[model samples]
Target chain A: MRTVTRLYLSNDTSARAAGAGVLADAWSEHPEVQLIRISSRGAFYLEPMVERDSPAGRVAWFNVTAQDLPLILSGTDGTPVRSIPFLAQQTRVTFANFGETEPLALDEYQARGGLSGLETALRIGPDAIIEELQVSQLRGRGGAAFPVWNKWKVAQQARADQKYVVANADEGDAGTYCDRMILEGDPFRLLEGMLICARAIGAGRGYVYCRQEYPGAAKTLRAAIQKADEAELLELDGEPFPIEVVEGAGSYVCGEETALLESLEGKRGVVRARPPYPAQSGLYGSPTIVSNVLTFATIPNILSRGGAWHAALGTERSRGTMALQLGGRVKHPGLVEVPFGLSLHQILEQFGGGMAPGSRFKAVQVGGPLGSLFPASQMDIPVCYDVFAKAGAVLGHGGIVVYDHETDMVDLARHFMAFTADESCGKCTPCRIGSVRGREILERIQAGSGTIEDLALLHDLGDTMKVASLCALGGRAPYPVLTAIEHFPAEFRAKLRT
Target chain B: MREQVKSVLARVRSKPPNILKALLALQERLGHVPTEAVSEIASALGVTTAQVAGVLSYYPDVRLTAPGRHLIRVCMGESCYANGCGRLLRELQDRLRVDVGETAAGGKFTLDTMSCAGNCAVSPTVMIDRDLYGRLLPSQLDTLLERYK
Candidate 1:
């Protein structure tokens, strides 16, 4: 008998809720249309999304709105699921089931190669899973694109009995929301991903340090953790892996894994010195696999489909899909799963649907609070980390922020400086003190009080934080300010005595 | 007097108020803690407001108000904002006659902004309680608000 595929009706829960119902209703009662209670995960775009068994793979491609539900139902998607222009363009490694499955459901996950990775990992052994992840080219989707396999291998190699796996869900970048979206869409995937990390890394416990602001994501994660416990998917030496949901009090620095671990242990969320990285000594002096939600989400997908499948999607070094929290002036501002090599223009125009309202796209603040701003002229730059760096920025968290012409680059620069200044943990002199000084320079520039000397001083302050700060939050804090000055030199130079 | 806070806090008798538990307790008691709670919390907890506010604003999840019984969290994050959350918010304000971050006179309706609802393609959507309303308008809110009334 078709299990009715349990559809959760929504507009009550989220777009995902209504989307799932609408998607379920679209399917002919082919012995597989089970409807479940609507979940409260709040991803309204992909409401009523289909389950794991849903052959409606197109759901993974776009955030299907309730209004689009009718078109989605009647819309016969004849294209091969992979070739669907929407999914085809995105690098789906991390967000494989974003639009495809019920986020909160455990059974739905298993139906579509969901837990197959865990099963495979358990069967083939953890070392082999590590090897495959290494070859598959899975890298961290958090701000830093560190290789996942290396982190795991390091954790596995680290001598410890109480190792841990933690998902860095404390995403608080102003123009970003990818981690939140993924959690809202398919939370179990994240839990399962963390579970897999726990298994391979020989972890006894795991934690998800979600930001305090993301109540929905936190709730989704909490429910998913409960679901994981119910299903007994968490394992330790073949036992249930002890993955706990730790709600961060909302420190922007907590997104930095170490700072997250500190907050998780009930301390202030502040940056830490690496080398004794979490891969070595983390989370209460235990070797830990500290990952971003996107990174964790990618694991199950990589495991189910095989690492090579993900590894094949991106450029040689930057493989798999990059989940983009498209923001700013773009028309379709949402999560975009694009191949790593796609140009920003393609992502912005084709995926994002172009500038919003009375606006000529101007500059973008990439990454989060710490990432830099890029001029529209650099829209040609590829989204790959290396390329973005060449263009004077690193694509942090893939937070593509668009500024229409009206947005003052100077103001934006000052705004970014102020944000970082406020968020600076004050742990390091450069970041703690330098960030404040940087804010002053921007203030000086904005007040028409600066000269080239002040501009030089601003650059100097930016450099000091970049090199001297302990964590990426401080290191990259100057990115937006520097990029703003580079692109809109006119704004600062006009105020400068050049 | 603060039953919700008492209930949640009672469970943490022996353990000191960790930031998570404290914030949860605060949110529980006040329905929504104001920005003032951050400062005033020290008096409540025998700590400083800066200490309280630091914890209050750090976590992305804790909000400051009780959304009227019918809470409509409109995604005003960049994606949604660009997708027309501005106009949508304006329309919501027009329909509700109350600006965002505020509850209605009758406590039947509350409108506020969110970072993102994860429903990017459905920009200009509203999440009332847990339910999400896509491509919303001032006119479309009546059905949702009626459920609460």
Candidate 2:
């Protein structure tokens, strides 16, 4: 047999625009080299990442360009990426095969323990599967850290003629890309995860509700679903289980479960009142399980590596690893999946290598645009669901967007409110009206035309919106505004001056 | 445009719940959904034109009017904004002579902003049509724009 060296090409957005340049060069010259396009390594700083599978093991190069093609084709040893402490040190249960394997190659995925979870679920059955999730203490990674198993248990018990499962890939969180990476890179992982969910709930059909913004992820996932279908991997319990990919028509509120379901059913993406929670009566009035892509992506690991093993990894209550995306002013911007107890200082300074050179770090907006803005004083705070909540912050999606000293908090806060106002679904009064009113107040301060009493009014409005809004989009629109005012009072006060 | 809409809706299931999908399909084939097609799509999907139009208008990407030759979407996410989408958008407006949510006079470009493109690692990202450009600077505009036109 001829020795074929496999070089992995990442389809990540950052890599897609940049990595394609090098891939074109490599393909033109080296036809013999088996160039495999894979998902992101989670660590984006090393993107346009190429992995060389050798007899010795895997040698990977990060930040590769077309200029590196000659040296790569020369057959000389490339950088051993796994040896890098940033990758080697962390526990990579969910993201284990990320950027390392061909995204949709079924045989390759199988060899690397891909569908083992579904196989295990098929063997142990739904009750045991739900039990495993409960024992694992896996909470939803979709901003709301609700227990994962509870949703599954409800869907399992709900006596509906047809059951549905949806992977919420509408990742509108500004600073987050892990969901995109999973959908694009390790798409099958999400597919397999959803497959596990289907087997658990006896779902006839599943849909990956991706945002239109992620054209790349949608394309990649579609291709993966096709590959999975061709491979006969779509079957569960000997019944043909089919999955479809639905594209969101650019509505931020649609990231909320009910809105996503409404969008999936081909309606105007609007928030539906809960209590008949998704598991109780969802999609076409059938019992449905709506999970974030990351939540589904985590299912494979829990099933393969027993629930107790996953439960032991993180802090009490919050179990397993979180895929933290470091963006903005950070020197090393990428995805880092660490156990839940790491502090912001460790994630920023130790893992992120701090802010870019000469730039003084000011604050980090955790979760997404809706997440609270934290000052440097709160660096020691651990990034867990409960810890962040106690500090009046949310660990929504675990996205850390750092800002330098030069950033205007008042302006950023105003911008976030403006974003909320722009994306509001016009469902209810508080979110629809309150977000615009909040932006107007912040803009008045930004224009130096506001009163000192305006701050008190903003606070009151924030309280009302928080209490009355129908969903998180409306409820949490006040988070950035209130937190910016609380943490950087001087910035808002300074804006009040001419 | 009527025939085009008819053909697009022909392939769709014509089910009540599939109004959004049919509209998306119609928009994909023809740059934007025509008003004439609304009644046809509504009839096919067994809904009123008002219902179809209501769902159509709710989405930001769905347009009543056709797009320019090139679509330029600047990401306004926290990372992109923090990295300088503000300056980038201003520079783009100055160079293109069009503001966000508007197209230029020549029908060459449509400028828009997204909450986030989810490519935050490469902050300050912009998407010109199908291709995404990351870590964009104002100076790169001339060369980047030349490729589209």
Candidate 3:
């Protein structure tokens, strides 16, 4: 009997964008080759990366095209997947299932330690689950860095007939794709995480408010939810815990927990004033547990492998691994899940493989669009929440976008302001109007028609937006601009009218 | 148009009556939500027309006006911006003879921008309808555009 060959390819959004779909179609045409689709290993630069199971383990072929099918089928040219420096030199907790199995395959998911978290949660119960989370020292991965157990505790304590577990998959941040990666790749993991959260919070129903931009993730999640429901994996105390996938309509502000609840209720994605926080009153005046996709994705691991196990990694305050996305002008732009304390310099140099050839790193904008810009001089700062905070920067959403020497800091500042102005919900004067004024001033400075007074006015505007704005959208909008001006003063000064 | 909107709205069976979902469903089925169908949608979703209009206007996804045959969304996200997506945008504007957020003269393409679609690894990404094209160059715009028409 002749043995058939099995091949693996990434179905990740980035991989597909890099032309995995076309390659998969080409490979499928062959009768001898059995094609299997799995999630990306987050080594994005090498996508359309194909892997074949060898006696030595899974060997990979990088940046494959439809034309490379013959070479891949022959299994003549490839490196062991784990041997790749990008894949080997990192700790993957949340994304461990990535590149291992087909995203929706429940059997494969369970075979590789999938439902053990839910099983643990079921055995231990809600109070113990919260205790495990507290021990884990896990903070919200969605910019805020708030303690995960605190929010779960509030919702678990709150008295409500209809409570909710909402996973904020509205990853609108420009340079971030971790949430999308989780949702698209190992969606069952996210479902398991949400199920555990529901079990902890005493919630009957859950909703994943995924962004409209990620249609693929939403579709994948919906399919995963259906699969889990059929397998009876979403049951809490022998009752069906229904989880629905709700799509966000391109609103950046909706990423905020309160605003997300508002949008989930089918209203405009406007920022809601606090006091009755989502943990207390959310999703139609009911107690809700709103957490980021990464945060929820992390819960399963913390549950399965004791919280102390997770706490063992990382710094004193920020525990466990963070999925850091490296994009823009980097040689090996991809995602790195590491214990939080590695310097930006180390991450950029080691995992990122430094800057792209012929390009020198000017600055890196950590977090997201609202994240602060750090010069090469500040690259030594450790990737800790407190460390980044002390440096007057945000570790928001763990998106690090590097800019080369060709980038104009002044124009980049203006671009951030423009994004804020465009995406602002217009509910507040500071974000809606101040953002526009900030853009105009930056434009004037860029055109060499601005005086020193305009710079001061820009600072004044930023300060007001920081303090008075309703939500993070308005409040944190000035971060990139202010940080750009502070770090690259010469660039801003050069743009001024002579 | 009213019947089409009603049919689309009827499909949305969520308990709380999702206005966003209804609007999205309507847009998905009809290409664009018609003004005439607003009343039907409002009634079906148990919302006032003003409320529906407010939601319709708030989101960038749901459209009030009909888009061109093919929709072209250029990602203006930080990663793409850093990789010279501006040049690609300019080339697209020249080739399509349309500015950002406007439909081309012949209605072949509608040029618009998304903050990000999380495809930053392949910077300077563009989406024509549902098909995503990445690592794009300004010189490649003409050839890419030729596929849709």
Candidate 4:
């Protein structure tokens, strides 16, 4: 049998998807390698990748096309594509291996050290895993600053018959892509992360419930799961543990932990009362460890590198890496993972490439809509969780959306209020209806309505939602509404009576 | 078929009332729900076709017809709203002649309004078939839509 070769030449979105078919046809003469494929996220820059299964070892390298496929398949070794400057510098902690290897091809994955963390776990026990994680000081990357160690510790200690590890890929938060980027770019890393979590907390099952908005992510995950199953990774038919992907039905509240569990149970998404927590009683009434995709995705890196190696990445109390989803009025917008405590200006200017050249920076909205809007001068503020807290902004989801000069902060407030209103799951009264009421006031303010009393009304509405809402989705739904009014008072005042 | 479905659903220990999980499992396997799934899912969950159909209808993302080959979901969320998203919405309507939630006639293009892409500064953005188009404008949209055509 001839050792055929398949090459993934690109990470350009459509090209990567389309090239798989091209490779299948290219290898028609020699089908022993089964399939040689290419994938690009349509980035256009990284094209012409090659994957060959030679006797020496499996060869999966980038920058080769079907035109070059014949030569490469004829056993011509290609130059490493990473040596190219433009393609080489992408710091892809999330998308590290995506498009470079076969998504479902387990042998390729295994050869490339895909599930080594799981293999390492197979050698060790859960408590050691927790110890390694705590030493890493890896904080939750899904917005909140809750220590990952504590959450896992709670799940580990919770008295329950069964524990679950659920990945909240339901990233309906207005400005977060750490989940989607990881799931689409590096599917196995996330799978390995979940498997590790299951192993850590004595969980027998895990689910990666992706939000309805991310079709590409959902498709990629489905493909990844079948591959994992075919490789005998997931426990099936009396096997020990099974990992699965649960597609969400397009609800923002489902991104909330409790609502996610309800939707998982086939009920209308509504938040459960807390304290018992999912650690106490979660999906299907089992003790569950519900973690955001970022939190879960961090596991493989933490385990492979050890905790101190990770703790070295960020500021004190905000240790480890952070994947910042840079958005809004910025020039270069995408995912950038750096150590925590990077200043806002450093992110906006250096990382974001500074607000579309001509645009003047007004306010940068951090963490999603529920997060605060920082005035531009405060761009010097460090982006650690505590620093953001002192400034009334939060590190929620590490999403940085910039607003330019022409953009009115009042209009921004209205838009955030509108999103919160539409996305509220109707479980809690404040977020359910209060978001609408708040949105109406925002509308009145934007449409040039009401007296100064509207500001007070906005404040009151925000306070009520904060005090009474079941989950963070509603509790902080009013942050954008209140913060915009407090910081950009003139915008709201402009709408009020003379 | 019910027996086959029950056997399959039993693989996950799904209860009789967990119709959503069952339908989702069907969607998971079939990519999208098939009309045939109504009968199979109902039978599997010990419910009726109407019950299954009713539940499918509740989910905004579930498709009765095959989804478009290329889905362009423009983020109409607040961050997008503040940026040139208003113009992008208008541009999409002008090009596709359909509002958010409506699919295009050709089935190649479906323009739906997603709440957020989480890439807000890159607002006025449309994820064409999940390939994100950041910092989109009327001109940029013209450049992008022409590719599909």
Candidate 5:
């Protein structure tokens, strides 16, 4: 049989929304052409990135449109497009398989060192696997930044009839897409990561708690699960451990671990008090380890290449790489997997190519709506978990949303409060009421009715909410408001009543 | 609606946790989880109608009433907002003669806002029914909405 090389275009959210599906349909009629549907290249700016599997390597084209099809199909489109310099400089240990192999294509994945981590783990056994993770110095990418090994060791030691592992795919953060990129582009890696975690903890079942807003990700995951099942990749030494995906019902609070479990069990996604943490008793009263998708995604790389190799990359405390999702007013806006020590200036100027042409750099929001806001002067801060905390900012989920000069900080602060108020599960009085009050205060300031006394009240209310709120939704909800007032005091002052 | 709910309920075990799965299945088949369907789901899952209704209402996706012929969900996330989605949303509402959370008169369209559609690269994204339009401008909305009408 003569092999006809395949031309790939990812079926990711960015591509699909841009009418890549229509192009795929149009190209399907040609027998001479093989259009393989793979995942995104992570740098969404280059999508509908068209790649052809050639004798030399995968030839690539950028921003491919319907009109370019004839030129490409005719073999006139030359060599696979060279690696983008932005992507070339990336550390890329975790996102190694993205845009390189067919998603769920076991042969393609296996050829490119896909399941080597799992193989290493199976050979070394569970104790060694846990030790390797500890050596890696990896932390949760799901905003909390808790050490990954701590969670795994606790789950390993806690004697329960059944142990469960969950991947938090509930990426409710506004400007983040790394979780969706991994799930849609390289789903098998995510599954492999989960498998490695389950093996280390002696767990029988796992689930990916994904947000329902992402119908594309959900569909891709279902397809990938079938592919994994067919290959028997999830089975460890004849003990079958199945991984299931549970869709979140459009609640931002559910992104929190406890609320996630509540939603999984068919509840209203309310926050539960700690001490009996999910690590201790979770998911039907069984011991569970709930981790973010990136936390698990990093596991395969750590196990494949020794934990020391992973640990050697980043700062002493925050090891390995971080998948930075650049959004808002940036030129090269997309996902970048870089080492953890890069400064905000390097990320914005070098990787992101600074703010999009006309938009003057004003402020950047790190993390989600609940995350702190940074002024242009604060761009020297290195992107490390501990460093970020010390500097009064957080590297939550590595989502960097840039704002131009025209943007009103007062409006942005109000928007954050509004988002929190709308999404609050009403689990605690402080969060439920505090967020609404904060929104009203910001609104009053915006309407030119707020006094300087109102600023003091806002700060006091923020402090109360920070201490009294149930989970992060309320606890961190004041971050943007307080930071906005602190950093962009002029914006609030200009709006105050004379 | 009861028969439809009963059929979906029959597929899964009559357990407490299956309420979400059951409601989702019902929502997929029927646009919304109707009052009758909620009662049937509650009875099948061994929970009360209020419990089932509470679960449905809690989720932004699962609605009580059926959506209009076309669902226009604008991405209101940070990226989209930065790229002038607020203007696009306002223009869409004005053209449709409806608010953000209401369905248009004569049952043609339902205007709503979503968190993040994961289409950050192409900001100001709008999904009309199953088709998503990205990098949307207020001027282009009329032409885009024309297809659905």
Candidate 6:
């Protein structure tokens, strides 16, 4: 048999955006080499990183370009992928299969301990599975931090002929791609998680409401579902538990569970008031278990390892590992999944490799665009739900975006207000109109035409939005703006007219 | 245009019609959902035209008018914004002679902005059609646009 070298390249959006496709195209010229496109390891700084399966192990070359193809092909210069500090440092639970297997390969997924959770769930009954989830103390990773078992149990008990398991892959948060990473890279894990949910909740069907911007992730997920169907992995009680991928129409508010349910039902993405939550009435007036991609992706592990085992990892309230996406002015922007309670300073310095050269870190925005801005002084706060909540900040979606000295807080505040105004579903008055009013005030401040009264007015508007808004989109929309004005008041003051 | 819209709707139409899916399919096939598609889709799906139009207008991705040959979407996500995407947007507007949400003079390109594509690790990202380019700078606009044109 002629020996063929296996070359691994990341098919991740960020990796491809960083020119992985160019490298893959260049390497494909040689027929002797087998090109295996794997999911990104989340060490985005090293992309378009390539790995060559050497005699010893997989050796990675950082930032490989077409020009460096000669050395990569010759197998001369590369470091062992495991030894890379970025990949080796953290605990990877949900993203364990990342960069390890081809996204759509069922055999590859199975060989690497996939479907073990479903097996465990099959062995144990639904009540026992819920008990396991409760014992594990697994909270939803979708920013709300709701207990996962609570939702599952409600769906389990609800009397409905049709129930739904929805994975909110509508990761519209800026600086966050962990959900995208899971959907694109380890999609089977998500499927396996969904299967476990189906078994627990008696859901007949599942839908992954993927965002329109992430066409690549959606494509990968659909392919993975097809493979699962072909392998009979999606069957329950002799009927296939059909899983569909629904693409969002660029509505950020749809990430909210009720809105997501509304959107999934083929309606305008609008926020539905929640006396009877999705767990009670959702998806055409049926019981629905709506969780984000990361939350669903975390289920398989909680099942396979036992809930108590997961419960032992993190802090009192927040258990297991949190997938933190570090981006912006950080030197090494990527995904870091570790147990809860690591300080922001530690995460930024260690996993993020500190601030990028020539830039001094001014503030860091944790969670999505809706998250609060924390100054460098507050970086010592532990990365846990309770502590962040106490500080009036959110660990929403675990997106940490660092801002350098060059960033004007006023402009940023304006940007977020504008973002909220633009993305408001127009169902709520406070979010729809208040956001526009907030943006105008910020713009006036930025143009040096605002007074102290405007600042007071902003605070008043933010308070009303926080209290009266229908959903988190309106409620949390005030967080970034309020936090900005609170932490960097001088920046806003400086923008005042002379 | 009516026939094209009807054909696109016919292909995606199901028992319980997925209006969003059908509209998306129509947009995918026709580049934009023509005003004529609203009633056709509503009638096909047993929905009101207002419902169809409401959904069509709600999503930024589903457009009302035809776009240029190529679509250019600059990510306005926080990370991209932090990395000076505003300057890049201005540069694109100046160079293309078209503002955001407008097509160029000769219909060569349509400029738009996305909330975020989740490619924030490499900030200042731009998507020309389906291809996403990251770590973009204002100075590189000329070179980047040259390829699309």
Please write out the lDDT profile of model 2 over residues A393-434, one tens digit for every residue: 889997899999889988998999999999999998999999
Off by over 4 Å in 6: A1-3
The residue pairs in collision within model 6 are none
Query: Per-residue alpha-carbon lDDT of model 1 for A24-49, expressed as tens digits?
Result: 45553435334444332222233334
**How does residue A485 of candidate 4 score in lDDT?**
74
Q: What TM-score does model 6 score on chain A?
A: 0.98
Candidate 6's TM-score reads 0.98
Report the alpha-carbon TM-score of model 2 versus the true structure: 0.96
The TM-score obtained for chain B by all candidates, in the order given, is: 0.70, 0.95, 0.94, 0.74, 0.91, 0.95
Q: What are the lDDT scores of the predictions, listed in order? A: 0.68, 0.87, 0.90, 0.71, 0.84, 0.90
Better of 5 and 6 by lDDT: 6
lDDT by residue (A191-301, candidate 3, tens digit) is: 999999999999999999999899899999999999998898888988889998888888888999888998999989888889788999998999999999999999888
- Model 4 over residues B1-149: C-alpha lDDT tens digits? 44555566666445537767776665555556667657766666777778777668666666666656677887776557656787778888888888776778877777777787654533556777656665556776777788885
lDDT (10s digit) by residue, model 6, range B1-149: 78888788778878667788988898888888888667778998998998888888888888989999999999999889888898989998898888899999999999999999899998889998888999987888888889875
lDDT string for model 6 (A264-312, tens) is 8888889999879888998889999999899988988889889999999
RMSD (Cα, Å) of candidate 1? 6.0
Clashes of 1: 56
Residue A77 error, candidate 3, Å: 3.0
Candidate 1, position A32, lDDT: 39
CA deviation > 4 Å runs, candidate 5: A1-6, A53-56, A73-80
How well is each residue in B11-39 modelled by candidate 1, as lDDT tens digits? 54333345546676567667766664453
Fnat for the candidates in order: 0.29, 0.80, 0.83, 0.46, 0.67, 0.83
Q: What is the TM-score of chain A in candidate 5?
A: 0.96
DockQ of 3: 0.84
